[model samples]
Target: MASKIAEAELDSVEKVFAAQEAVPSWKDQLTFRSFVIGFLLTILITFIKVKVSLNTEIIPSLNVCAGLLGYFCLKVWTQCSSQLPFTRQENSVIQTCVVAGSGIAFSGN
Candidate 1:
């Protein structure tokens, strides 16, 4: 049943969170690099959203687009620099910032 599936998902989420807390990464999640990347991505995504809105009136989903782009960009950056740590927390922060920035741009119109 759907209820059983939902309960299983909830249980899995709980276990994941518990495990995360048990093994702390202890890495800096809010680094300057994350902010810089997030700022650039926000500007880029905002511009694209504005242009798309003007042309097709169909705004793209910032969460999916920004998350994927941010992840890819960070991965590439890490591979190149080899100094920056690619932590999930940092990626989530950057993605959230970019998405929020794009949302603000959309609402301002």
Candidate 2:
């Protein structure tokens, strides 16, 4: 019945939430590795933005680029090491730095 299905879905959702809460979250500390990677990514993205700006009037999407780069880096890191990979907060921090750096580069042009 539709009611049974709804109840089942609700139970499943509750179970998932319980499981998530039981798992300890990663420490919120900013590691040196994250800082260095974010800085380097910002520089690299800014350089690419400037180069593209020089060649064409169309501006590149730094937000998307930053997100993709962050995701890729985290994925690679997760694969290469047994340690916990960067979290969403870390990715957001990296993207913010990239956007700010790229904005400066654009303004200087």
Candidate 3:
């Protein structure tokens, strides 16, 4: 019985060793490259949202929600696949920009 188990283990190890595969994690996942790209995209969208809010005279409630939603998305990104370290400063910046932008947009509307 012991020999049988040992043989099975050896077979499994050999099979696994024979397999050629890329790294377990995605090559671009959570790299500084991806983080920077996401950050820039967020900035641009925030800018557009504020512009629209101003043009349409949106309400404060919607502005607040929009900002919160942006942070929520960031949270998801960080939790699921982000290799980037989460920081208080980063979160604070995101929250501030999002809230301020949303406010400006909703107020305009």
Candidate 4:
């Protein structure tokens, strides 16, 4: 059974490795704007989650809220500044960060 599982893993790895392309550097994605936006969203989302949970039994989906809000805010930010173009990848990272940070904050309460 172990051998069979190893063979399956090896097959999957080989298939994925063959299709892989040169990954873009994450350093470029780690911008000051991303951190600032992520941190602010984290605080905002955490507060919303805590308040909602306190008033009602329903907890809002963090990912959905974060993604929507992050994209909208980033779009507005882009319009205000012509220097940086907001990419889907950056938005995703910010959303993930906000969700994670918010979860931690909410749980801490």
Candidate 5:
């Protein structure tokens, strides 16, 4: 089973490298749509976190929330439109922006 997993990992890496060679490098993955969506989500989550903090002693997990939200959004987008210009790295950047914006929001509070 371990060997099988290792083989699968190697195959995946090979495929990634092959795909990388075929695809042109994207100069900018930070689209306005992704930025706006990420910013809005961060604001919404931060607001929820603040509200929860104020209403109860338990603190919400922002990291988990941000990760899950980003994953779900990316998954949905990928499923709905395979032709969309969004790439995996772009999704990553979006998530990072979301987390950073959330941190800024928290600092302000």
Candidate 6:
């Protein structure tokens, strides 16, 4: 049964590839989008760190944790937007953390 399912999936994949190949000059390049997204993320992280650092009311541990959380958030956003190539499972891992952390961070704010 598994083998049959796998075969069916392979057939669909073959059709998809064939269709893609038939397209004329689709660029298929993500370099510019990737650069822009990365730049935006860097700016955001820097801004957040600078702003948060001004108020030392937050514990040092908390700041570190938040910074790490921001990093993960950036990664998740980039991946979800197809910034970098990843398998479905890899994307899911980052996406799950992104959503949970975003919820916590926003509510805390």
Candidate with the greatest lDDT versus the true structure: 4
State each model's CA lDDT, in order: 0.84, 0.75, 0.55, 0.85, 0.74, 0.47
Runs off by more than 4 Å, candidate 4: 1-23
Give lDDT tens digits, candidate 1, residues 1-109. Answer: 9999999999998887775554345456777778888999999999998998899989878688888888898888998997856778778889989999889977898
How much does each candidate deviate from the true structure in C-alpha RMSD? 4.2, 4.3, 13.8, 6.9, 3.2, 11.7
Model 5 has an lDDT value of 0.74
| Model 6 ranges off by over 4 Å | 22-30, 45-109
Better of 2 and 6 by TM-score: 2
Model 6 TM-score, all chains together: 0.32
**Candidate 5 Cα deviation (angstroms), residue 91:** 1.5
lDDT of 3 by residue, 1-109 (tens): 9999999999998797567443334433334533453455455655676666578866224444444554566667778885665443444455555555545544554
lDDT score for residue 47 of model 5: 89
Which candidate number has the best TM-score?
4
When sorted by lDDT, best at the front, the candidate numbers are 4, 1, 2, 5, 3, 6
Per-residue C-alpha lDDT of model 6 across residues 1-107, encoded as one tens digit per residue: 99999999999988877754443332343234433433444445445544565676442223344445545655676767766552233333333443444445444
Clashing pairs in 4: none
Count backbone overlaps in model 6.
Answer: 0
- Cα RMSD, model 4: 6.9
Question: What's the count of clashing pairs in each model shown?
Answer: 0, 0, 7, 0, 0, 0
Residue 95, model 5: lDDT of 77
**Model 3: how far residue 78 lies from native, Å:** 2.1
Show where candidate 3 strays beyond 4 Å: 1-71
Native-to-model Cα distance after best TM-score fit, residue 9 in candidate 5, in Å? 3.2
Task: Compose the digit string of candidate 4's lDDT tens values, residues 22-96.
Answer: 454698667778778999999999999999999997878779889998898888998999867876678888998
Residue 10 CA displacement from its true place in model 2, Å: 9.6
Report residue 102 deviation for candidate 5 (angstroms). Answer: 1.3
